[model samples]
Target: MILHDFLPSGNGYKIRLLCACLGLNVTLKEYDITKGETHTESFLAINPNGKIPVLELDNGQCLSESNAILLYLTEQNHLTQQHQSALLPADPILKARVYQWLFWEQYSHEPNIASPRFWLTHNAMTDLKKRMLPDRIQQGHVALKLMDDTLAQHTFLVGDAMTLADICLFPYTHVAEEGGAYQLSEYPNIQRWIKQIEALDWFIPITQG
Candidate 1:
């Protein structure tokens, strides 16, 4: 498998992190999204949406969208006896909870947190983004608070065991302060959760491929 990705991207990092946890060997195809690399004709052929983190399987089929790839990897891992813990639980209720976090991350978390981080850190800010920043930051706090409150009740997002939900949210949430949009200090539970994830043996930094 090959991961078409940009190293700095949390979305790309999501797939990379999961592959590390699953002990999967996937070739990394780096792209400098800063240079419009993902928009090139060849990259476009892989994902018409022009996004990074497209996972190309051994048979040449490609999967786009980060959370979808996470689910795919976990499902594939479930079929083998290699990984001990299940990232996506078999219980219907628990699986639904995992799905909930994945959807919420895209809709409520990423747009507010990830977008502002990108705009500020990458020098991509504009007049419209400047106007949008305040509101995004506010909503980001709301999203973080929700995660914090939920995490305050359990070790991980869904329950005691770590699930796909934690992996999905960790990338952006851990580095949210980069663009001056958030302070992890304000969310103590989240801080603790971040530490717990980092201490895992297979954990990989976002900077890692």
Candidate 2:
């Protein structure tokens, strides 16, 4: 398998982190999105949407969307294990909960937190984005608070054991303060959660392939 990704991207990092946890060996194809590398003709052939983190399988099929790739990888792993994988539970209710968090991250969390971080840190800010920043930051706090409140009750997003939900949210949430849009110190539960994830043996930094 090959992961077409940008190292700094949380979306890309999601797949990388999961592969690490699953002990999967995947070749990394790096792209500099800042330089319009993903928009090139060859890259466009891989993903017409021109996004990074497209996972090309051994048979040459490509899967886009980070959470979808997470599910695919976990499901594939489950098939081999022939039992419930801690990353994605087999029970319907538990699996639904994991799905809920993944959807929420894209709709409520990523736009608010990830976009602002990209705009500010990558020098991609514009007049419109400047006007949008305050509201985005406010919503980001709301998202963070929700996660913090949830984590306050459980060791991971869905339950005591870590799940795909935690991996989906961790990338951006852990580095949210980079663009000054957030202060991680304000979310103590989240801080503790971040530390716990970082200590995992298979944990890989966002920049690691």
Candidate 3:
């Protein structure tokens, strides 16, 4: 399998981390998104949307969208049933909760957190991007506070262990202060949850050269 990705992208990092945890050896094809690499004809043929983190399977099929790829990979790993139950639980309702968080991350969380981080850390600060900051921070805090309140009651998002939801949400939230310009220290439960995720045996850092 070939994983087309841009390192430093939290979306891509989620796949990399999951592959590592599953002990899957997938060839990584790095692209510089800033150079319009993802927009190339070859890449567009693979995923017309021109998104990074496209997974080309051994059978010559391609999958796009980070979370979808994550679900695919996790579903492919049969060992997860005995070892990584939280990833995709057998219970229908438990699995639904994981999906709930995944959707919320893309809609409610990433818009405010990841989008702002890209503009603040990677893109040139233009008038429009600059103008978007206040609203992003406001919405970002709402997401963080909600997570904090939920986490104050549980160690992980779903059942007893970290699920797909936690992995999906962790990267953006961990780096929230960089984009939102609000200290994570203010959310003590979030800080504690961050530490818990970091302590996982197969975890990988988001930072990459």
Candidate 4:
């Protein structure tokens, strides 16, 4: 499989991390979105929206969206589930809870962590006009508080063990501190959990280039 991604992007990190964990043989194709590469006619043919982390299969089929890619890559693997309690809850109610957090990650989490990171860390001052500072800071803290509160109780998000939920949320979240909102020191459970993830054999620090 050929995975076209932005090497520095969290969305791309999601797939790269998953590939490493699953031992999938995926060729990495890095694209420079900052240079308007995604907008090119050829890339738009593969994905009309023109985004990075576009996974193209051997048959020439393509998939976009990071979460979708994660599910696709890991679902059938032995490590498809590491800790069910934290990620894939066994109980119907708890499983639903896991999904809730996963959904929240995409909806509530990324807007806060990823968007602001792009503007503050990557983009030029001219790009600043497009960002909504008040909303970004507001929503980012909201997500952080939710994580801090829930993580205060347990070492992991959904259960005692790390699950897919953690993988889904960790990318944007771990870097939320850059947005000036993350205080992992205040959430000891989360701090411990971060360490655990880092210790995994397949784990790759997304922050590193």
- The estimated TM-scores of all candidates read 0.97, 0.96, 0.94, 0.85
Task: Give the residue spans of candidate 4 off by over 4 A.
Answer: 78-91, 125-131, 179-187, 207-209
Candidate number achieving the greatest TM-score relative to the actual structure: 1
TM-score of 2: 0.96
State the TM-score for model 1: 0.97
- Candidate 2 segments exceeding 4 Å error: 79-85
Clashing pairs in 4: 86-159
Residue range with the least summed lDDT across 10 consecutive positions in model 4: 78-87
Candidates by TM-score, descending order: 1, 2, 3, 4
Each candidate's lDDT (Cα)? 0.94, 0.94, 0.86, 0.74
lDDT of 1 by residue, 1-209 (tens): 99999999999999999989888999999999989999999999999999998999999999999999999898987632444557898889999999999999999999999999999999999999999999999999999999999999999999998889999999999999997889999999999999999999989999998
Model 4: per-residue Cα lDDT over 1-209, one tens digit each = 99888877888887787777666788888788889889899999988999988989889999998877776765545453442332354578876777788788889988777877776677533545455766777787788778878887886787667766788877777676764545556656666677788888878887433
By TM-score, how accurate is candidate 3?
A: 0.94
lDDT by residue for model 2 (103-143), tens:
99999999999999999999999999999999999999999
Model 3 clash pairs are none
Residue-level lDDT for 176 in candidate 4: 65
| Cα error of candidate 2 at position 179, Å | 0.9
For model 4, what is the C-alpha lDDT against the true structure? 0.74
Query: How far off is residue 131 in model 4, in Å?
Result: 6.7
